[model samples]
Each structure stands twice: as C-alpha cells, then as structure tokens.
Target chain A: MAVYTEVPDSALSAFLDAYDLGTLLSYKGIAEGVENTNFFLHTTAGNFILTLYEKRVNEADLPFFLNLMEHLARRGLACPQPVRNRQGEALGRLCGRPAVIVSFLDGVSVKVPGVDQCRALGQALAALHAAGRDFGMTRANSLSVSAWRPLFAQAEHQADSVSPGLAARTRADLDLLESAWPTGLPGGVIHADLFTDNVFFIGEDLSGLIDFYFACTDAFAYDLAICLNAWCFSPDGSFHRDRAAALIAGYEAVRPLEAAEVEALPILARGAALRFMLTRLVDWLNVPPGALVQPKDPREYDRRLTFHRQARDARDYGRA
Target chain B: MAVYTEVPDSALSAFLDAYDLGTLLSYKGIAEGVENTNFFLHTTAGNFILTLYEKRVNEADLPFFLNLMEHLARRGLACPQPVRNRQGEALGRLCGRPAVIVSFLDGVSVKVPGVDQCRALGQALAALHAAGRDFGMTRANSLSVSAWRPLFAQAEHQADSVSPGLAARTRADLDLLESAWPTGLPGGVIHADLFTDNVFFIGEDLSGLIDFYFACTDAFAYDLAICLNAWCFSPDGSFHRDRAAALIAGYEAVRPLEAAEVEALPILARGAALRFMLTRLVDWLNVPPGALVQPKDPREYDRRLTFHRQARDARDYGRA
Candidate 1:
C-alpha cells in the first residue's frame, strides 16, 4: 500500500484546473502501486488515475514510463493512456512532485491467479511486448543480471539474519546468474515487473496492465521468466507445471519463441529469481522503523531460484 | 491512511454475488478512515464504498451506526445511504469481518477549510444533528468526558515523553473537566467526530458527512465544540474568531442553540479538547512498531486545551 505523499485538497483542486477533465467529483488516495502515490479520481467527465511519482521513481525516467504507457495504449494494448494537460504536457508539478493523470482501467487483480488468468496474463504480456517493438524509446533494465552483485552487496552481511545461510546461497546464485546470463535473445521494451497485482482482470478476460515504473528494454523471454516466477509459484513456494505450461502456450499463441529463447528459459528464470531476491533481500533488511509496506519475503524468490537452478531445459517448466 | 484488511479478488467477487449491484467493474482499497478497511467499488450499477469494520469498531454497535445513517438520509441529510443486500440485510461478512456497502457521496474534503466551507460544515452538522434526533437507536460517545480520565491513565507515563509537563497539565485539565463539565444541555444524536476530513464540500456547499463510527447521543453543543477545535484553529494554534463566528452563525440558522448550550460552550470546548488529547496521547504512545497509520499529534489538542483553559465565555469562541 503506497501513499507517501498526501496531496492536499487545495493543491489537488488547483492541479485539476490545468486539465480538461470536468469538475472533480471525488478522488481518493488508492492503496496500490508501491513506487508512487496513486489517487483514483472521479470527475464530471470520466474516471481516471492520478499518479504522483515518489522518490523510488527516477525523475529522469518520467518521459520513458509516461511515453511507454501511451505508446502501449496507442498500439492496442490495454494500458493506461496518459492524459496531457492543457499545455500539451503529460507531466506536471503537484505538491513538489511530478504528477500525471491517466485513464482508469476497469478490473480487479487476482491474488492467486487461476490457470485461465495466467493464460490471459501471458497473452496480454506478449501483446504488450509486440506493441512496444516500434516505440522509439529505450530504458536499460536497471535490475537485470548486471545489477545483481551490487544489489546483493548491500544486503550481504544481513542476509543470513533473515534466514540462516541465505547470504552465501544468494552470493552463489548471483555468481551463477552473472556468468550464465544470456547475451542475445529477442529484446524489446518489456514490463520488467509484471507481477500478478500489476495485471487487472475482469473475470477471465485481461482488462489491462499497469505500473510500468520498472519497464525497460530487455529480453522479452526474460519478462516471461519474471511472470513464471511471479504467477506460476504457489504460496508454499512450489512451482506449478500446469500454470507455467498455460502461460507459455498462451504466449506462443501470440508470438512463437525461438529455439535459443526456449532453451535459455531456465537460466533466464534463474536470473529473474536472483534479481527479485536481491532487491527484496536489500529491502527486507532495510525496512524503516515504521514503514507501511511489509517487504515481500525474499525466501519466496529464493525457493524459485532453487527450482530454476536444477532445471535443465524449458521442458521442465511444462513447455510443450 | 487506513487499509488494514486486503480483500482478495475471489473473496470480493463472492461477496458481491449477494448484491444486485451489477458486475464489479473495479474496486480499490481506498486510503481513508483509520478504523476500517474501505474500498471504492465502481460497478455497472454505480459507485459505492465497501467498508469492512476493523477491530477499532465494536461489532455490536454496527446496527446503531448503520440504522442512524439510513435514518438521517431519510430525513434529508446528505450522507451515505447503506445499501441492503437481497436478504434485506445492510450488514454482511467479507474477509471474515463485518462489512457493508453504502452509496457513494461525491465531494472532496477540505484540508485547511475556508470560512465559507466552515459555514457550510456548520449548517450540515446542525442538519445532521437535527436529522438524527428522531432516530430510535443511540450509542454513547465512548470518547466523552467519562472516558477521558481512564484514557489519560493509559497514557500518563508517556504523556511527558511527548511534551515536558504534559502529564501534570493533562491531569489538572481532567480534574477541571470532571467537576465542571456541563450536563443536560440540549442533547441529541451528535456527529461527535465531524472533523474537516469527515465533512465533504464541493466548492462552498457541504455535499455530505461520513465516518459515523463515532456518532453518538451527546450534547449538540459538544459536537459544535469539536467542530470549533477542528475547523477554527490555525496551524499556529491560534483561534480564528471570524471562522468560528461564521460557523456558529451558520449552525444557528438551522437549529438555534439554547441559552444553556451557549453558556456551556467554553467548558464543552475544553472537554472536547481533553477528550481528543487523551485519546490521541494514548494512541501516540501506543502506536505499534512499524504502524502504517501515524497517530496524530496529541500536542495539537494540547495546544487547543491551552487556549480553552483561559477562555471564560462563549463570546471568546465567537458564539454570538
């Protein structure tokens, strides 16, 4: 739950004046999207989402994220379309933070996604990758294989404090991921953090995808790997082969994977596991005295890393 | 900001099955109401607020609160109308907690409320008091004069930790309030917690009053006193006499204050101050480690107590 910045009523009223959206009927600070303060706005014209970029989001990367959402939406991907202000600017200042309003998508995110939802997610994700192929912008994936060691270094000493022998195991995983990380795969603008919560669904239909803060130019298969780690893992940290199979089959229905991409899946899955583990490890060890957000247990990804470490081929993940 | 309970998608979908409210288009955990989990539900039928009663609210008192809202709304008060399910029940279970859905009110709450807004709030509050008069059920104000001493006892040790000499000062105020607190001065059901955030205004018109968890049978003047402390104090802790005057005058236009009620205003205001101060002091000291909701500063009410400590008559509060 994220609402680090409290947008004052007067500030919000003044901010809405700059937009063509009609009289602000009601707005609420929505407890969603960890990286920013989000408000669900209902106005005379229509419902929309007002996002105030927080400290976690890089100000320099604002154009990349805002443009990516607009780009994805224009290309027929169901994503939020940024609403430019009267000055034709999508970005503006509100309460000393960069803020923008976007069209509100209508769907609820599944906590434990079903097999059908997994398929829907895979198809939507593939469509998102296809939609962003021609958008003339690029952001290097900051949490990819290259950043694992540095990220792990921050939590090295305290990692075992969370779980005994976690530090050594993480270091070993990081070493393996760095050495075996794939150099060439079908690369494009990818939703680097498409967790189940980020994708919305109305029943079995995928309504839209949101929270593009971590999106960057990276392997599309690596994005697929992130989904496998996120969606296909059971609460007990066991991998579900059926969910993974459905996800992969759904993706292939949109765009077939190359042999290299298919074979590289296990390593990429391992790398994705390592990436999330490192970040969560660092965050878990450094949660402030009274943070609203409880850090996601790094052990979840650690277990996923363990599974990927032993898997030899895509067939192990139920890829037909 | 409050979202203590996270209603999973399946649980939410199943919960909505009992209602005629069309297919759930979207729902987000709204960051509002400290004592309950609130979700802004937008459905094909219309927008509504789904509130799951948390620990802070007493389960047995649900009927009094829910019935009062329906009663008040029936008598031409602008407030959330509780939507009963097909079983003719307004209260139901969701996520293992007592929950209910109410029609959404459209307006934004003012932060630093303007004089006009204060006037509107005054009128609306009086109307709420009037509308709630005939409501058969009643709940005692749990944070009123009788609760202050026991509440203070809980926070006594750490009272000085917040501010030097606060403990002794709070004790003296408690002594004065216990002995001199007015009784039998135009009593009715009062919106005891009608703070600025609970009163919504679109421009200068008060659209609605919400958060009835603290609504109780108490002196109408005491509720006015709470409003005075809430709306008429500047950030500097100085009283805004003009705003207070506007508020009282606006309130009297709807329901005239009796001579006894007018005369009891200063002491009631002080009692109101002490009530909030003691509760806030207890909350401030006992906020659990890593709490999402920050306990409001007791010192704000402490300062108001200081102002009311010296105030001799209703004239000082701009109550003409």
Candidate 2:
C-alpha cells in the first residue's frame, strides 16, 4: 500500500511513447506493492500495471524479475508477463527510476484464506517451482538461513522490548536454526515469501501469483515451510492443521516431496519462522518517519517459532 | 491515498450480487480520494470506481451527491455517473459503510496544469454549474465562508506553530472576509473543491471532473474563486495572470459571469483561501493516529490569502 514515486504527466506521456500499449486513457497510483511504486494503467489497448522500482529493489535484478515473469507465464503459470517496448526491452527508466509494464492479472488476494484457497496456493507454488527449473537466470536467496543471524544481531538489543522474553527466545532459536539447518534437500527456485497476500484467488481456484521480487534459487521444501508459517496460522496464533494438510497434500499431488525434503520440513519451517521474526523485529524497532505502513507485529512470527519448536515431523504439519 | 475500510471477499461478492457489474475480474485499492476508500474495479462489464464513504462524509448527503452526479452526466457533462444496482439503488452498505460504484472516467489529472489545461478546466467548471442549475437538490457548503471562523477556532492555538504570526493574520483576514463577503450573486451547485487533481484532461481537452463529495449549493463566483486560488497559483506562491485570464475567459464562453459576480471575485477569492486554510490548519494540527494521507500544508492557502488581500477587483484575476 504505497506510491513512493510520483510520475509526472509529461514523464508518463514520454514513457508511454516508447511502448505499443496504445494511447493512455487513464492511470492511477495503485496502493499495491510495498517495495515499488505501481500505477494501474488503462489504455486503448488494454489494462496493465506500471511498476517503478524503488531503492529497495536492485536495478541490476530488474531483468531477472521481468524475465522470470515472462518465463513463468510461458510455462502456463498465471502471472503478469512483462510488456516489452519497441526496442524489445522490458526494462526502461521513468522519473529516473527503472520501470516496466506488465499485463494486469485478474483476481483478489484473500486476507484470511480458506482451506480451499490454501490448497490452490499449494498447487500454484509447486507449479511455480517446476516452471522455474530450467530458467536461464539464477538469484541466490538473500534472506535465507545464512542472513538470519546478522539480521537478528541488528535487532537483538530491542527484541525483548516487543515482548518480555522475545530476545532470549530469539537467540536460542537462532542458535538452533544455525546449528541444524538442512542442506542438499532438492534445492531450486522458490517463491521465498509466498504469503497469502502474494497469492490471488478467484473463489476456490488460484488465479495468479504476484510480487516475484523475492523469487530465488532455494530448496523447494523450504518454500512449503514458508507457506506453513504464513498461511497455516490463525489470528489467535493457533495452527490450522487442516489447512496445512490440504496445502501440503496439494503440493505433493503436483510434485512429490523426496524423503530428505520431508525430513527437513520441521527445521526449515523453524528457520522460516525465525527469518520473518528477525525482519519484523527490525522493522518494528526502526519504522521510518511518516511511514504509512504499520510494521507487522513481530510477535506473530515469534508464536510460529514456538509452534515449530515442538513439531517432531512433517506429520505434525498434517502432511500425509 | 486512503483505504480506511477493509472489504472482505465474501462481502464484496455479496455486494456485487446486487449489481449487474458482471463478475469482478480485479480490484485494487486506489490511492485517489483523500476522504474515502477507493478501489479501481475491473470487471467483464467494464471498469468502475468503488467508493466506500468514510466517516467524514455525512450519510444524509449521499442522495444529494449521487443524484447530482447522475443529473450532471445526464446533461452531457463528463463526470462519473453513479451506477445503479438491480434494486435501482445507487448506494449500498459494504463493510458496514455506505458504498457506491460509478462508471470509470478515462483521463489523467495533471500535477502542474498548463495554461491550456486551465482554460479547459474553466470551461468544464462553467458547464458543470450550468448543468446543475435544474438538479432538484440542495446542500449547504459545509466548509463555506460561514464555517471558516469556527474551523479556525479549533486550530487557532496552534496556528502560529504552522507559520509565524499566522494566528494574528488569520484573525484579521476573517474580519475582512466576513464584513465584505458578497451575497445574492448567482448561486448554484458548485464543485467547491475543484483543484487540479479533481479535474482530469487528455492533452488540452477536459475529459472528466470527479470527487463530487464537496459539491453543494453555493455562489457560482465562489467556485471560480476556489479555482483561481487552486489552478492559477504557481509552486512558488506567485499568481499566473495569463492562466487566470484564460480560465475566466474560457468559463465565460460557456456561462457568462454577471458584473456583480465579477466584482465580488476578489473578496470571494479571499474567502475561498480562508476556508481551505482553516480546514488544512485544523487537519494539520489534529492528524489522526496512523493517518495515511498527509495533511496538505495550510500555509499554501495562507500564501494565497495574502495574495487575495491585495487583489482589488476581478481585473486582478485577469478577468477581461
């Protein structure tokens, strides 16, 4: 829910001239992506989304994100395909920021996803992983296991201020995750932050997946682990095992989990919880001045960490 | 830049069931209106704007605003006509707040409007006033000249904090406006808040006028006064007489201003400035917790007030 850059009318007209999107009819700054400025564009040709990459997005990675969308869509994945300009380039500059236009995907993201939606999400996540198997580009997961400890160090001093015992518990969890994090468990490209908000649904069917900025080469089971932390938890911090079972079963139906991947699920889930908890804690501690977005409560992930600690196997996640 | 209410998927589906808008393909919360939740809805039927009226708008005035849009569009003015549901109702409750869907208008609002654009705006504004003459509804301007004094009182204590000597200068201006404010100079339904953002244009052609929440029965000259303060001022607080002249002339080409209305322009402009200044000051002083929309600087209007103070007659506004 942000518009970090304001594109002027002249700049917009100039920017659109390079593309074959037809005459611009209307465009509005959409409260969509948090890390970039998005304008929902209406033109004579069709509707599209114009994204201006903010400072948080690496300019060098623009090709990776745009090309990956094209790659996924080419493989029958429902995602926004980047519209190239007359020069055959998907990436360009607008208002001195790297920008691209993508075909608008049709669906609404559910706030509290139902079990069916979770199942559909699981299927789509597996499909995405399968589609990216032969993609030409590769981006290492920046916020994966190795980054968690340093991220924790930045927020360590103030972690307990969020909750009475958050600091000590976080330190213990970090030590556990660092010591026991799994390797060689069917690694490939994963939508690392496949939260409910990133998956759009039309009724019970998943229509599209969006915000591929966090897409990276990582273990496929770790992606499922991230989803368990994101989608299987209720507002009361209770894990909905039915939804988890549906999600995991839905994933296995598409691409069956290997024995090692199944074995690594618990620790990966714990690591996923810690990864989010550390970031949220840091954001909670240092919210920028006049930021419109309220930093999510880090305690939510802290509770997930507690749940993952006691889970003994993939069966505890309702995985059949 | 506001979405105060979170409309759920089931609620949205049920809400759309009442309308013939076809299946909702996509909807994104738009950062458009300041006082309401706005979503740009794209459906099989077509694009439309879904507005959820926030607490700031009076529920009793819903009919007036919706009907006025209906009336204006019927008279061939380019504006968002309120779409009726199957029950023939234009307004319904969504997320426990009154909501209305209007036909989407195609055009971009200029951030820094050119002189030709100003001329188009003036013509459209006059057309709007003429079109609304026969609309069988009346609403008093909530933030008109009479409301400025009490609005000021709310922020008077902190007025100087916004600008040095602002409190003292505002009191003097209020006295002048109250004493010299003209009466019986051709009143009609006026778009009282016709700023640059509210008027959309494609190139130099006025495409649409929107955000009619501020529309009310008021002096037509006062509407022009608001425009003069809004569109005719440069970024550095300097007035552009050529742009002002073009605006008034373009307006007169459609609906000629009476001599008395012309004579009243100077004081009307001053009153317009005071009205916006007081409201902005109060909003600036008392911003609600976690407010997404930044309160516009009250000092912009204060600067306009200073310019209006020395303005002698309509001639000063480049009215030929």
Residues B1-320 of candidate 1 have per-residue lDDT tens digits of 87899999899999999999988989999987788999999899999999999888899999999999999989999899999999999999998999999999999998888788878888888888888778998688888888888888888988899989999998888888899988888888998888988988776678899988888998999999999999999755799998999899989999999999898999999998888888888888888866779889889998998899999999999877
- Model 2 achieves a DockQ score of 0.69
State the displacement of the C-alpha of residue A29, model 1, in Å, after optimal TM-score superposition.
Answer: 1.0
Per-candidate Cα lDDT values, in order, are 0.89, 0.89
Instruction: State the weakest 10-residue window (summed lDDT) of model 2 chain A.
Output: A196-205
For candidate 1, write residues A34-112 as lDDT tens digits. 7789999989989999999988889999999999999888889888999999999999999999999999999888899
Write down the RMSD of candidate 1 (Cα, Å).
Answer: 1.4
TM-score for each model: 0.98, 0.97
Predicted complex 2: CAPRI docking category: medium
Comparing only chain B with the true structure, the TM-scores of all models are 0.98, 0.98
